[model samples]
Target: MQALKGIAASNGIAIGKLKLCVKLDDKIAKKPITDVEAEIKRVESAKEEAEAALNRIYLDALKRVGEENSMIFQIHIMMLQDDDFFDAIKDCISDEKVNAEYAVWQAAQQFSTMFAQMDDEYMRARSADVVDISKRLLSCLDPNLDSGLDSLKEEAIVAASDLMPSETVQMDKSKVLAFVTEQGSKSSHSAILARTMSIPAVVGLCDAFSSLKDGAMTIVDGSAGDVIIEPDEATLKEYEQKRDAFLQHQKDLQLLKGTKAVTKSGVEMEINANIGHPSDVEMVLENDADGIGLFRSEFLYMESDDFPTEEQQFEAYKTVLEGMKGKRVIIRTLDLGADKQVPYLNIPKEENPAMGYRAIRISLDRKELFVTQLRALVRASAFGKLAIMFPMITSVEQVKEIKELLNQVKADLKAEGVAFAPDFEIGIMIETPASVILSDLLAKEVDFFSVGTNDLTQYTLAVDRMNPQISSMYDPRHPAVLRMIQMAAENAKKAGIWIGICGESAGDTELTRFYVDIGINELSVTPGTVLELRRTVQQLD
Candidate 1:
């Protein structure tokens, strides 16, 4: 048996034949064009057809995936109509005097390469979007090409270099048992689509993926990121058993929805969801999460061209709060700076951005920005249970300062005859070492402690988790990081305050028992993983 490891893109297991998929061919021979206007007209016609195709795809994706995930297709439609992209194609056709196909291909390459080189991960993933739409346009120009998933007649594990959003959506999903890609990340549209589609997937297999052959028996343990090819008799039987058990395990876990996350010993832990936008509240409720643990407010800022107005922020907070139906919602105040830079904010470049002016630093420096968000949260709190948390907190002074600001917001609201929830909780994220060290003191001031382990691990280990070169060194399970978390948990307990982990680490089912043992009050993860975490807790003592 030969095995390959990759990033676990989606959860589940599959055992089937390997069916290799071919990517859409973007290579077109350049032909000198005599009629520039005619070629431009052709490009314009193809562009409209592409947009119409995307609109249809958007509706199809909306049915398969939710509105939030389906928005990517709508984004592609917008990209097709983008002035710069359209103008680039027209300019290429006019300057290079190339065929419309060649001009579209050239413009796509230029933009895709530029996006791929960007510092932001989200923008980097957009390179695929450019290529996807270009291929759609190419197909519209010529009727012969397709994304290549239409040939599958049998259920098999689909292997590809990297599946694009359009290709993944257009594929006959019923025939695909699992997906194995040579290049992709969790943030990629393909991976996100897999999760929403509930298909087993393993991506970024790189060189190991070359060994895969058509019609070969394969076992894909997506939950473990393992792909086994041509397994021997014993190994095949072992995996067959494992696959059966996993399928049964999934069915078993579904029964856990709406049930509390309680261990065998009857210790309960709140299993909440981390959401970037209000639209995600549907999935949180679908998974029956205890509440909303981390509502990343920065997405509201990141999505807007300018700062989101107080009423805009209020509506968003209100939508989520109302959606949760009185369930506890913890909103992390604007964590702008570093990787999540807003162009309008005009934050200066930093040598090491992760540790530099970010999170609470930005909030404190620009008090008005912070005040705007707090004012929105305060006004929305009256709709449902809400808890506001400050990120990148290092000292008691920051928490004290935050409370003073909160008090002023309350006073202002009162004088203006605005009713707000006074019983809402205030908390600080135990991410920095300073916060962990001073958790004993910080706990007394705050109502609770929510550990942002993603940052805590990086900060404690002095490793940039985003740097692929050193990502291996940034272990959240490292002893030092665990020690810091344990210290904070102990301190919170000592101070008689509840504590929880609202980070990527919380989604790790392997650590479910560890968290329960350490007296963690809650585990906030992706909405889809809530039941799995509940299962882990129930199985543990």
Candidate 2:
């Protein structure tokens, strides 16, 4: 038996026959076009067809995976119409005098190459999106050509060089027992879809693809990122037992749904989910989270082409609030800047972005942008339980300034005859060391404290978490970092305000008891981890 290792993208185990995904060869020779206008028209028509196809796919994915995960298709549709991208195709057709298909391919290559060279991991992963959209355009230009993923005849493990987001979303779900890809990271859209669909997936198995024979019996342990091809009898039997145990564990976790996260001693803990978009509420509801701890308001801006208007932000917030029914949803206001940059905002790039103009700094500096968001949040408050949280706050003065802005927003709304919940709570994230040092004073200024350990650890430890050279030094469990969190918890209690953790460290089961002992009232984590955290909390003393 040949065993291969890759990055685990989802949790599950599957043993099935392997089926190689079939993809159409898109390589085409560039040919001279006699009529440039006709070529442009052909390209435009192909784009229209591609957009329509994507819209249909979007609806299908929306129904199956909810809106958040399915937003990839909507993004694909947007990318098709982007001025820079579409203009490149048109320029290639007119300037290079090439066929529509050739122009599309050329444009795809150029943009994909540019994106591949990007410093940001998210933008780099988008290189695949450029290829996916171009393939769709090619299919539109040539009716005979097609993007695969619809050819599955039976249940099997789907292996491919790489599955695009569209192909993964459109694949026959019942026939796909698991996914094995030769190239893709855990953050890839295909991997995200696999997680959303609860399909076992192992990606970035480049060397193993050479030995992956079609119809060969294979065992995929996604949780362990292991794939064994043509396993021996003993190994197969062992894996069968392992798979059974994992399935049982998952079934047992499902039983924890709708149950409170309470210890044997009857200490109730709140298990909430951190979400970036409205559609993620579906997963939150499915996981039976107590509430949304960190509603990242920046994604609504990042996902858009330009500044999202007040009404647009309001609708998005209102959607999440109403969906949660009366459960508290803490929305962090506009944490933009640093790694999360908006090109239109045109904030000058800095040498040190993490400790630079980001989060509350940008909000306070750009009062117009901050006011617009606060107005939207105030309006959304009428829909359900809403709490506003500020990030990267280092002083009481910043909190006072935020309150001033919020008070002005309320006054405007009240005078305009608009309905808003006046009882909405205010909170601040304890991310910076300065904030943790002043936690007692900061806590008194807000209704609650949510320790953002991801940043708190980075700042306190003097390590840039994104810098690979010293990422090993960035440990949230560092005694110093934990001490800071404990200090914040103590100060929150002293100020009569509740405290919680809303960071990557919140899901660390090893630290759950430590947090409980430090008087942490809540733990907010990714939606998939809610049940696991609940199980951990229930087992605690």
What lDDT does each candidate get?
Answer: 0.84, 0.85
Instruction: For each candidate, give its TM-score against the true structure.
Output: 0.79, 0.79
Question: Which residue ranges in model 1 land beyond 4 Å of their true spot?
Answer: 1-9, 16-19, 23-156, 164-175, 184-197, 214-218, 228-241, 302-306, 337-358, 462-467
Candidate 1 root-mean-square deviation in Å: 4.7
Model 2 agreement with the true structure over 34-148: per-residue lDDT tens digits: 9999989998899899999998887677656654456677658767878899899999998988998888888898999998777754455567788999989988998555544
Cα lDDT of model 1 overall?
0.84
TM-score of 1: 0.79
| Candidate 1 minimal-lDDT segment of 10 residues | 463-472
